[model samples]
Target chain A: MKIVFIFLISILSVAAQLTLMPHLSFLAATPNLILASVLAWAIWRPEDKKEWFILIPILLFDLVAGQPFGLITLSLCLVFFCLEELGLIIFKQNDLPAVFSLTFLGIVLFELFQVLLSRLFAVWHLMEPIRLTAFYFYGSLPFNLLLNGALSLLFLWALNKSKIFQNNGPLAKLK
Target chain B: MKDIDKSKWIKFFIVLAVILLLIFFNFRGLLSAPKSWALFAASPFLKLFQVMDKGVSGSWAFFLAIKDLNKENAGLKSENQFLFEEVTRLKEVARENELLRQQIGIGQAEQQRLVMAEVIGYNPTLGQYILIDKGAKDGITVDLAVVAANNFLVGRVAEVNANFSKVLLISDSDSLVNAITQDTRISGVVKGNHGLGVLMEMIPIDAQVAVGETVLTSGLNETIAKNLIVGRVEEVIKKESDIFQSATIKAAVEFDKLEQVFILFP
Candidate 1:
């Protein structure tokens, strides 16, 4: 039942990401809700094997909106693992600051991985090469990081207030 | 601890293997069936969210406009009276023009067959695209021209499934349309500026371009029709050292707010 609920939430997130988020753009980039939600879920329920659960939306997003499939899934999966390792090493406590840091690093690595893989795909004659313009690094990235960071923090706060972290949930044990 | 590390490595390999398999299937065109089925199931949800978005945005816009409602209402009444007279005159002129064309044996230069489609989704990533309800079943194909009201150029169909298609907005980095200034007839190629806006480039340095000149498709591209309004020149950039000049275009169609569009059939 939990798996099914996650699956449904993933579908709604993808749909909202597509239909609604574009209208809410700041600095020509919209906040990545799926990325923020996944990162927050990882921190909130780390023991539940949430990394694998995160792949549900990742796959749906890839199928629906991704061009040249597997780029997003590959980048995000690697980002997920990196976040896990970082959480274990540094952020032993799942605090709000830790959420911000993890989200910022996750978004940065996501962009880096996508750029590198897209170049590789171009070399293999699978797609056209994307030019790394100055606007991307200087203009868009800062706004994207800011938006995702705020969103992830918001999601974490909501999770903290919700029942999932209270009675009959995993975080109840911690409390 | 050592066993935990080993298990983590195993999970990583499992992810990598699954991604590789999916990539192979995607590139081989084997994933389209499942993808279509998934999208077909999700289309209703997309449309529902679209309606919700529209209601929210519409209410927000109304709230913003409320402060100036009285002044704008008074001004619009006068403007509407003038426009009513102007429209009556134009209707008569159009009727005369139709008779003259009939006498000249020119039955309309072109009869465009347009299939109307409702927007269902948008691209979630950086690339600019909108998903529509019409698809191959409705005769939508790659490179077909999509337009909004007043014959404003939107973009072309980039991909199609059985029940849906993706329209690459004119603001997409990969989009290019051959266009010209409507009055001066100075030719240029209009391309997207990283999804932020559109830019018309490759104009001869000597061409006398001005701000606010209307840009139209040149019909140089076979897929897109001629004289469709792309945008107006908002700013001009000319450099002494550069071989060609370029101008920033304000697109007539708001790519973000599009709800319905007509796909042109050739």
Candidate 2:
């Protein structure tokens, strides 16, 4: 049931990203909501078995988002796990700062990966170096981060309400 | 317990290795098969969301839109009245011209056909493009010129699938069209500057090009018809010691509000 719920959210996020978010863009950039969903889910430590399922939605996103296969999947897997492990050591569970910060770092690294990979894969026009990094960062980054922060809060609330992973304490280990 | 831990580590490495290898090699072709099927299935849901989005966003846009519409409606009405008078005058002139042409043993002008399509959605990449419902099945070929109301130049067909095609907006960084100033007849290359409207360049420095002058297609490339309205020159850039001058054009068609287009079959 938990997997199904996350999957549905991922589907909706992808659909919304493609269709509706353009209407909500600030400076021609929309928040990377799917990436935020992964980070938001990673904010809490889930059961070891359930944690692996996070990759499924990201993989689906890679397929549907018209990006190179496995680019985001690979990026999300490494970043999600890194945040999960880093959060375990650096901050306690439900810690908004850790989720927000790691999500911030995740978006930066994810965009870097997108640029580097787009160049390597020839998916983008190669006539000039992609200024997408600057374009993404100029005004879009702050907006994306704020939007992702809000989404993380919403997911955190929903996760706590579901009681899928009981919160004994902020630092309580899930495994 | 130690032995079990070592085995688990080895299992982890193996799994990670396989996944990495799969990613290292491109499986996009293999994966895109399922993706196309999924997109095909989701097309209806996407369309539904598009409509729903308009309703939600349109509420805010509607009022602001009404004011602009009123201004445009007034402008268009006056233009229409002037055009009506001009057409009535030109009809007699055309009749006389046709009689002269018949006397000279010349032929009638060829009629061009156009295919109309509604914009279904906008492309969600850094590049500026819009998707329309016309495609090869609709006789919409790649590179065909797309125009909006009043036969104003909007864009060109960049890519075409079976049932849909992508139109590269004239504001995209990659777009270039041959254009001329309507009053001065000064020809230049109008290049897209991403989101910044088009820039017309290669005019001789001494040539006269004025702000507010209308721009039209030169049709030197044999692709589109001549005299299709491109935009109005908003600003002119001239520099001392430079051989050429350029002007920035404000496209007559509002791309953000683009809803329908016609594919000019030249």
Model 2 stretches astray by more than 4 angstroms:
A1-11, A38-44, A48-94, A123-129, A132-175, B1-35, B65-80, B83-113, B134-142, B201-205, B220-227, B237-245, B264-266
Clashes of each: 0, 0
lDDT of 1 at A26: 69
Instruction: lDDT for model 2, please.
Output: 0.70
Please provide, for model 1 over A64-144, each residue's C-alpha lDDT reduced to its tens digit, 9 standing for 90 to 100: 777777887888888888888788878878676776778788888888888888888777665555677889888888888
Candidate 1 interface RMS: 1.5
DockQ for every model comes to 0.64, 0.31
Candidate 2 per-residue lDDT, tens place, B147-262, comes to: 99899998888766556667888887667789999999999988776454688989889999989999999998567788889999999999988999999999998776677899
Task: Report every candidate's CA lDDT.
Answer: 0.84, 0.70
- Best prediction by lDDT: 1
TM-scores for all predictions: 0.88, 0.72
Interface Cα RMSD for all candidates? 1.5, 4.0
**Residue A119 shift from truth in candidate 2, angstroms:** 2.3
Docking class of 2: acceptable
